[model samples]
Target: MMKNRRFSIFIVIILCMVSFSDLKAQAPANDKASVKTFVQHFYDWYNVLQADDDFTRKHHLSPFAFAIKERGNYFDKPLRQAISDYFHKPLKSGETGLDFDPIAAAQDTRSGFQTGNVKQVGNTFRINLHDLPKGKSEKEILAAETFLVVVAVKVGKDWKLANFIYPAKGNMSQTDLIKLLAHQKKFGY
Candidate 1:
């Protein structure tokens, strides 16, 4: 009777361990799915901004605050606030396009600019974009105008845009871009 009781307890412990491992394995998949959904929604929001001339910067960009970081005095303000200031600042008389178009260099994903599905690499997710048009010369297509890599980081329960890395011209990360903006005193208010 004693031996049978010990065996039953051991079996229960093993089963519980197996179940816990299974749960742990499933958690990452769930997180990935959630992050992917968040990114899709973010792009949708970005598209809407393109059409509206008076789009609210804070309203659109604040939710991803967790994704932005300040380095030294390069950016003393919060990421979203800094971006809002940058967008709302007055431009010089001759400056026509002072704003950065997030999707300007990227080929439309709906039109086959994206190479593959979003890939999770370590803590960051990478989305690749190519600047290829329909009837470009072989050299132009092979040369590839620009290769844009958008990176996202998971912050707590949400995912945030971390950087837009452009590899052609020595690879500029979001932090680097913000630093340039700060240097130029583009961040306002």
Candidate 2:
């Protein structure tokens, strides 16, 4: 039984990989552009959170909503405002701030999805993130490691970060949660 379950997971991952491979060829340029766009959009929305009337509207965050918890800080906010605030603030070069560099990114055609895996031993850290010097020790690996999955439907020529969340696993990771909330925006579920 255990072997079966593991096999099932393996199959799922294989399928996901196959999906990504197909996209790799056709999507090399297209998906790469989307991935780059998502990063720049997210970076500006987060690291360069300076108030800009142009970006404020360009972000189209008013329609989106995002919420994720880190340490004790609740990361949920109106999509536009949340990303706006993120870009509005300035972070020091090596500081453990909201914005962190992505180690690698891939575009999956089968799923029409763009995903990126952030390494665990990179310049930034996202451990429990409260105690700092002491807190840094525990989740040192987890801190720097997280994943961002994005869903985009082409608009004109560029792809925008419709919605994104952190490393995935259970509810704690919050990717599915964001998707759920994204769906319930109108009905108020």
Candidate 3:
């Protein structure tokens, strides 16, 4: 009963959310320098995925990786499954799972960081994200979305997801709703 146009848009939106997730993940490097490094590293990882990343490489995520998702049920997995499932393929060690074009990706990254927040609490790192609603009231409700994450300590100088929660509508998955889409060719729905 659903049209392909709707299906395509759904897929695009999910992928964009996954990309945003990547852009937002970080462990917070001690000081301002460390914070910048942490954010830049994650940015690079996202860039690779945007590029030709055929398989997903392992990530040293913060301990509070999915804290927001867990508390709010926005996502159930350690990270967003929409992103994880797409990169389920195996990748060579030391290779980037995702890569982005340097020039354009840099510009986008710069703009994105201009409006974001990252905080640390002992071993866990928390994140809060908000964006302008676009040509409207500055005092009015802006993006009005926030997230809380609690990251865990990893091996020396590293960290991975411990728990995270994100307030999300948790939209019905397009992958499950649609039938006969190329991705579901095997089931032949």
Candidate 4:
């Protein structure tokens, strides 16, 4: 009888371990879904405003900058502070603040931007934003060029925008929004 009891306890322990492992696997999948949903919602709302020239001009807004300023709550603390510091920092003679929209990495937008792949490493998620082919979705754009990458960090059970990563091109190395802001002295913003 004691042998049977010990065997039952061992089975229960094994079952518990299996159950926990399954739950652990599922947690990451749920987090990925949550990140994707959040990014998609942000881009959908942002793209509409980006395409509206009249609204932007009337409100004296650069679309992405306006979004960052007005919706500051959506960003992670460090990135938001970096942007605020950059914006408020006085420009030296012949120096310029950021001229292009860092989110889209362009001065003009065509309303074709869409959230592509979302990958998470630890607490950080790298989400690719791609420009869809004319009249076609990004899925149809065979190797669609990445416009920019949005970095989001998990914060208190939610995801918040951390930075925008522009991929390397030509002689320039890959750089992120915070780095760009901090390097104003070197790159002139």
Q: Pick the candidate with the highest lDDT.
A: 4
Task: Please report, in order, the local distance difference test score of every candidate based on alpha carbons.
Answer: 0.50, 0.36, 0.37, 0.79
Candidate 1 global CA lDDT score: 0.50
Candidate 2 lDDT, 1-189, residue by residue in tens: 999999999999999999887664343334454444454344333323223335337655421222121111212234444444444556555543322221112121111122233212221112111111222443452344344543333334544334344445566545433444344343332
Worst 10 residues of 4 by lDDT: 133-142
Ranking by TM-score: 4, 1, 2, 3
Write candidate 1's Cα lDDT for 78-160 as tens digits.
44454555556777666643244434343223332423245777666766544543445545544554355566666556566
lDDT, candidate 1, residue 121? 74
Say which prediction, candidate 2 or candidate 3, comes out ahead on TM-score: 2
Residue-level lDDT tens digits of model 3 in 12-103: 99999998886655444554344434533443443343343332234333212322223323232444453344345455556553342221
**TM-score leader:** 4
Per-residue lDDT tens digits of candidate 4, residues 1-189? 999999999999999999888665444667777887787788777877778878677878778768987788889999889888777777888876887888777788755676778887656888887776336655654367776888887787778999899998779789888888888746664
lDDT for 163 (candidate 4) = 89
Poorly placed runs, candidate 2 (over 4 Å): 1-25, 50-143, 169-174, 182-189
